[model samples]
Target: MPCRTNEELQNLVEEAKREAPAGKVADYIPALEKANSSDLSAAIFYPDGTCYSAGDIKDQFTLQSISKVISLALALMDRGEEKVFSLVGQEPTGDPFNSIVKLESHSPNKPLNPMINAGALAVTHLIAGVDVTERLERLLCFIQDLTGNHSITYNKDIAESEFETAFLNRALCYFMKQHCVIDEDVEELMNLYTKQCAIEMNSLDLARMGCVLAMDGVDPLNGRQLIPFHIARICKTFMVTCGMYNASGEFAIKVGIPAKSGVSGGVMGAVPGRFGIGIYGPALDEKGNSIAGLKLLDIMSKKYSLSMF
Candidate 1:
């Protein structure tokens, strides 16, 4: 792999920011409604250990669905593959991320995949500690190790906001419980899920986290093994199949990498053996993805030939 200097990568982010206004910011979350629709930022870590970043890369944002990947990875490490797979499927549902139709209609009522809230909630239940607190601590430890940053912590305001307006998620939890798919207390599991989503960090932290997945579950900069290779491969596969909510197919065609997006206007793309890319633009498209972030990845992937395909 050729070396990409910080300046060149920064230039890509600026060029991509020009497309920010092409979409709107996500407003359903209420707290996320205040974000500037045109905000754009990107951080990329190359194989040769260079970090390039530009725009609002330093702005703090919640992980939202991006936490799903981390939680699932932890669950895999704790329970291994068979148990996790039994609770969640790998197939992509073209349906909405929060769709309950399959849960009601399927025989066992398991979630379609780990990337969705349903699957992620299931994965979270399998986190395998005595309580939710321990599980969350484990998750935080994994994230801190992956990022090589110990200062990361959850944003209480964001967690409270989601907890206040998470009727849909609560209902989903009940549905899973009704089917006996979730064995733990619904309140505990949901609380853990919400907090995981609310853990705050900027693009630099996310890029470093992505570095773990990009390096096949090892931190490239420090060579720390945060997750098993199988777990990383599974998470990356899910990202490619279902990470962008309903836009996964289109994104795969355009960016051609295993990527995940969250309602908080964050996107993490893991380019195997090359780098982990993170983007933050509070503005979102209909699919709840950072609109400007997607455009930025499309632009960078094309320019640098970073597509996994």
Candidate 2:
């Protein structure tokens, strides 16, 4: 297989956009439902220092569940992996990302993995902070440092909307609390997780962020070590195993790269030693991933032999 030129990659995104309507934009939350379902965008930054973007690359969206990557990494850095894993299991849950049955089934009630809402909430609870404000500030700074973009901020409207309608998540956290998996104030834990999920970014910024992880915590552009190499490795491993919710196994087989997706239609992929890819297609599959974005990655993986497997 040959390396795809930027023009060819952009063309692929355009082609994938046609399938956007096969999925629907998430409407469970009022703010998320406001997204333009037809929109699509993609950006890629290679280790060789080339960057490319196409379509609505300027459009900003929430990180949604994708913020779990940062929260988990920060937890590892602040606390040890042993402690974090004790609270959140590393295995993928075959059930839905937000299922409560899996939590209750385990003796310790550990979340299946940090990518799901249950695990992510636990991970967020573990972030070292005096309060939610301090935790959010640290997490925000970590993201800004990773992307070298200080302008990123949470979408207040989206965060507030999630806060207003997080009854199921509240129930889930209380269950974890019962087992001592999450001891933080239930509302505070939910607020912090919701705010982090509301972090806004565009395709190019996300690609740059993914490039840091792809390069194993070092930014090729600046040669800065933003995260420890081992922690970054752990983060990528989870991305491969559970980043796409239950569809992660299929994604690993087809796209075969380390990637994470959010309900806001953003997919971040790190092709180790190659390039970091970012995609946004507001229409979502039932699993909450970007429909057109996954289609494009599958096509590119086969065409360019990008899969790690």
Candidate 3:
């Protein structure tokens, strides 16, 4: 029910652009450093198959951490809740997404949750595949089905860049392997994980994916169940709890929706039965969320009472 017109959404986007100066593009990944910090776009997809967008909605970006949500759903469908949770905890951590402090401090040595780097690696390990190619294909197929965009594919440049610079992620994989949480080759896992994170799409595709989640795993285009209902619920719960890196609690208080954000400055939001939102602004806050994108969501949440809370 939010942003009934594209003009209304554009107005919100312009207002939110004011916050871009307070943020910076993510430069840790050498490839991501090239993004235009001021670039912002958004799209909203409804269950009725209607969509409205504003700004540079056609521009594409890698999924980065947003892939965690999709991977988690696939992992759940591949491995049941019991097996998956045994390797990753359900609790949210206050630490940064890439921090390794919890793995050392926690008794079980399992990562606190799947949204973090360590836990996501573990979940990715569980993705059903005999080799990296097959696993990556499975994930890609799932994403394609979700968005109804079969052209969705990983950016090879970004994937190679991330694979080359993923020292911290490698460490997480090795540590999890040591604890018996993951038993795959660290390098192979890194290869698949990097490619998973590098999957690319524009705001419209991202919104369509979110709309699938909003509809509890049913494709709004044809009512086909792409994800199981219980699995979708679990993924949404994690989004509410740990989706925006360390800023999730604040995001919940202010935006009050089930959402996930990536370091690529992309946020995917599912407002329960209402609609799905996709936002992209390369300017990132200190917590790695899209600065203007967050503001845009806040404004929309307030103006249209879009918050599920």
lDDT of 3 by residue, 1-309 (tens): 667889988988999999999999998899999999999999999999889999999999999999999999999999999999999999999999999999999989999999999999999999998999999999999999999999999999999999999999999888989999999899999999999999999999999999999889999889899999999999999999999999999989998999999999999999888788999999999989999999999998889887777
TM-score winner among the candidates?
3
lDDT of 1 by residue, 1-309 (tens): 422566676676677677667778776677877778777777877645678777767799889999999998988888888988888888899888988888888767899899888898888898877887888898988888888779998988778788888888888899988887797778888788889999988998888788789889987766667788888998999999899998999999998999999988899989888788888988777778887788778887787787778
Which candidate tops lDDT?
Answer: 3
Model 3 stretches with alpha carbons more than 4 Å out = none
Report every candidate's CA lDDT: 0.84, 0.90, 0.94
Give the range of the ten consecutive residues with the poorest summed lDDT in model 2: 1-10
RMSD of 3: 0.6
Residue-wise C-alpha lDDT for candidate 2, range 87-139, written one tens digit per residue: 98988888988899988787667888899889999889989999999999999
TM-score of each: 0.95, 0.97, 0.99
Candidate 2 wrong stretches, greater than 4 Å: 1-6
Model 1 score (lDDT): 0.84
